[model samples]
Target: MKRFCFTAVSLLVVPVTILVAGPAGNGECIRTPKGDITIHIINHATFALGWSNLTIYVDPVGPQARFAHLAKPDLVLITDIHADHLSVDTIREIITDKTLFVVPPAVAEQLAQPLCQRSTVMTNGQAATVLGIKIEAVPMYNTTRQRLQYHPKGRGNGYVLTLADTRIYISGDTEDIPEMRALKDIDIAFVCMNLPYTMTVEQAASAVREFKPRIVYPYHCRGSDLEKFKALVGTDLGIDVRLRDWYNK
Candidate 1:
C-alpha cells in the first residue's frame, strides 16, 4: 500500500465543534448540514447516535449495567442475533411504544409478543424509510469458505443511510466483500474489524481504499490492533480515519 502523500495543509478542516465532542459524555454532537449527529460510546460493541430527532442504536449490548444515560432509541438496528448485537433485555429496556426496531429476519424471530409489533424486518436488498431517513439494506457476510456459515450470504445486511446530503454506511459483521468495494460516493462509514467474526485490519483498509469515504470510523473492532488499522489508512488511502475509544474496557 502506498503511503498517504497529501500534506497536512491539503486536508479538509473539520470544525472544532465536531471534534470537541469527545468520545465520552452526553450532548457531544457532530454538527452536519443534515443535523446534529450525537454519539455516546457505552462500551465495546455498543454505542448510540442521534441525528435530527432520529436516534440510532447499534449493537446495543455489553455491560447493560452502565448504560443508564442512554436515551431510548427512536430506531434500533440489530445486525444479528449474537448476544453482543442483540440483547433482548437491553432492547426491552430501551424500547418504547414508538421505537421503530429494525433487524434481520433471524433476530425478528427471537422477539416475542409486543416487541414484535413495533419492529420492521429487513433482509439483504430490502429498504425502507424510517423517520425521514432512507435506509438501504446491503449484503453482509464472509467470503472465506470455512467461515461462510457464520454469516451466510444474503442472510444479514449492512446498512447505507442517506440523511439529507450525507451518505453513511454501517458495515455489520462482514469480510471485505466485493459489494462493499463497489459502493460509490459514501460520505461517512462505520466499519467493523475483528477476528473470528469480521475482517482483518488489512482487509478493512483495502475495502476503504477502494470505496473511499470522506470520513471513516472504526467501531466494533475488539481485541485487534487498531494502530495497524490507522497506519494502513494513513499510509494507503485518502480516507480520513477517525479513532474513537469505543472498546476501552
Candidate 2:
C-alpha cells in the first residue's frame, strides 16, 4: 500500500490547499457535513475521490503508476466502454479482493469475469447505494445529428454520487442533452467538452448555467479553451469554476 502525507496550504478564498505527492499535482477538497472529499485529478476523464477512509476511482484508465500515490479503491465506477473510460489492464492492476464496482450495462459486458462478478450494472435513472455512497446513473449521449454516431443514447452513463449529503455529478462523455440540463441540487459537477466526441465549450457552459451546480470543473477537456468556458459561465451565477490540470503528464 502506498502512503501519502498531506500538508495544508493556504488559499485566500477556500480554507484548505492540498499538497500531495503524485503525477496529479494539487488536490481540491470539498468540505462536507461528515468530512472532506478530496479530488485527485489523474488525467482527462479520470479522477480519484478520498472520503470517509475510502477511495473511489472514476473511469480509471492509463498506466498503473499514474495512480501509485493513491490507495486501492474501495469502489470503482465505469461510465462507459470507451477506451479512455474503461481499461481492463489498469483495473486488474489496482483492484483488491474488497473493491466493488458500479458500471453501466455496456461497460459491464466488457469486463472480465472477476470484475463482472463485482459489478452492479445500472442503466440511466437507476439508483443504488454502494459502499455507503448513493449512486444514480444519469443518461449520457450526443444530441447533435452529426455526433449521434459517436455516443448513442443509453450506451453510457453520467453518474450522480451523494456523499455525506453532498451531491456530485460526473458527465461521462456526453453532449448537452436534456438530462444534463435537468439536473437539480448538484453540488459539484465534472462536465466533458471536446470536439466531435462531445459538445463544444459554449454548449457545455450553456447547460451548466441551466443546471447550476455549486462547483463545476471542466474536465475531459482535451483541446477546448478552459478559460473561455470559465468566462462564459461567469461570476454572476455564483458558480465556482475550478480549472485544474487534467492533461498534465
Candidate 3:
C-alpha cells in the first residue's frame, strides 16, 4: 500500500548508478513488457514481489511490523521449513482466507489443519500454475557432506516464477549445486551465500558466471562478504551483481 519512489544509487559492480526504487536502498522495481515487478527487500531472505495488483511474499520470516508497510499478499511462497524462511506466527497474522500458501512437503506437514488445507505442496521438478503464474520447484541442497544436514536434496526447493516473459529465480537455502548452474533464460536471480549454511561468495559468483542471468541480487548474506562477491562477478560475464542492505535493525 506504500507509494513508490525513484532514485539512482551507485553500486560497486555497476558503474552507471543503477536505478532503484522505494525508501530502502535494497528495494527496486524493474519494468517489463507486461508490467513492472517491484522487489521489496524486507530483510534477510524475506521480500515481497509485486506486479500489477497481485502481490507475492517470499519467506516472510521477520516480525509483523516488518511487513506493516507492504500490502497484504495474494499469494505466499514458503521456500523451506527453516524458521528463518518460514515463520508460523508471522503467517498466521498476515494470511487471510483468500491467501493461498504455496509450500514444500515438509512445511505442509507441519502446518495446521486449516492452513494445510489452504496450502499447495510442490516437490522438486514439479510445476504448478497458480493465480495465473507458472511456478516450478527446483532442486536445492548442500553439496558438502558436512552441510548435507542443513538442506537435504529432495527435502526443500528453490522456485522459478515465470512472470510474463521474465523468469525470476528465488533460490532457497542452497549451495552452488549443478542444478543451479544449469538454469536457463533466468532474467533475475536472488542467490544465497552464507558460510556453513550455503556456498561461499566465490562459489556463488562461479555459479552465476556459469548460468549467466541478466541480473543477480545477493540476499541471505548475513555474514558473507558481498564486496568480494561483486568484485568476483565481472561485467564481462554479462551479469549485474546488485548488492542490497539485508542486515538492518
Candidate 4:
C-alpha cells in the first residue's frame, strides 16, 4: 500500500520499493480510481501489474522460476513474436484455466491450441475492452531505414491500457515514432531503449517529452545509459523519470 514520493528536482531515480514490505514482493505502486496498481519487474521486458484482484502479465519469458514471487495473472499480453516476449513454456507454467490473452496477430499465429483459443488478436490502431480495462494496440517499430527490419510497422504492438481513470503505456520494442510522440494524457509509461533493436536513449527521451507522461519508467533497456535518459527528460518538463534495475536478473 506504499507509494513513491518524488521531488521537483530535474531528474530522480527512486529505488524500487517492495510495496508490501516482504521478500516476495518487489515493485512500486500507482494509485488508480479502483485501487492501487503494483508494478513487478521480473526482468528485461517481463513484468506484472496488479490492480485490485486482477493481475496482468506482459512479455513473460525466461525460466518459470523467475516469476515465483509475483501474483498469478488473470490476463496475459504478448506484444510481439520475439523469443523474449512470447514463450510457450513460460505461459504454460503460469497460465490457469481462466487466464485470457491479448496479442498482436503475428504473436497469435505462434500460439497453439488452448492459448490460441483464449487469445484476442489485435492489430495496430485497434482497441478492445477486456477485464474492465480499455486496451489499445499502438504501433511499435523501428524508424531508421537500416533498422526497419528489426521491428517493422504493424508487426508489433505498444499497448495503451486504461485502468479505471489511469492510463498506462507499455512500449514493447520501438523507436521514437510518430504514434508514440502523439500520445495524450498518459499517467504512467514503460518505454524501451536499447541499441541495434530499439531506439537510443536520446530518441527515447525525446519521445517521452512529446507525450509527457506524469511518470515514466525506462524498461527493457539492456545497455542504454540510464543517467543520460533521465537528464534528457529533464525536470523542466515536470516529468518524473524513474530508473530501475531492469537487468537485475
- Top lDDT model: 2
With candidate 1 superimposed using the best TM-score fit, by how many Å does residue 166's alpha carbon deviate from the native?
A: 1.3
Model 3 agreement with the true structure over 1-249: per-residue lDDT tens digits? 222211112111111122333443444788776677889888899999987788899998877889887889899998998989998999989877888877888887778877776677788887777787778888989999899889999888799887877788899999999999998878889999998998899999999999988889999999999999988988797687889898784
lDDT of 3 at 192: 97
RMSD (CA, angstroms), candidate 3: 9.2
Q: Write the per-residue lDDT of candidate 4 for residues 16-132, one digit (tens) a residue.
A: 221221232477777554568888888999889987689999999988898888778899999999898989889999889898898887887787766777777788887777787
Quantify all predictions' global Cα lDDT against the true fold. 0.74, 0.85, 0.82, 0.83
For model 3, state the Cα shift of residue 96 in Å. 1.6
Sort by lDDT, best first.
Answer: 2, 4, 3, 1
Give the residue spans of candidate 2 off by over 4 A: 1-26
Give the higher-lDDT candidate: 2 or 4. Answer: 2
Candidate 3 residue 64 C-alpha distance from true site, Å: 0.6
Worst 10 residues of 4 by lDDT: 5-14
Residue 241 displacement (Å), model 1: 0.6
Which residue pairs overlap in candidate 2's backbone?
none
lDDT of 2 at 237: 92
Of candidate 3, the 10-residue stretch with the lowest lDDT total is: 7-16
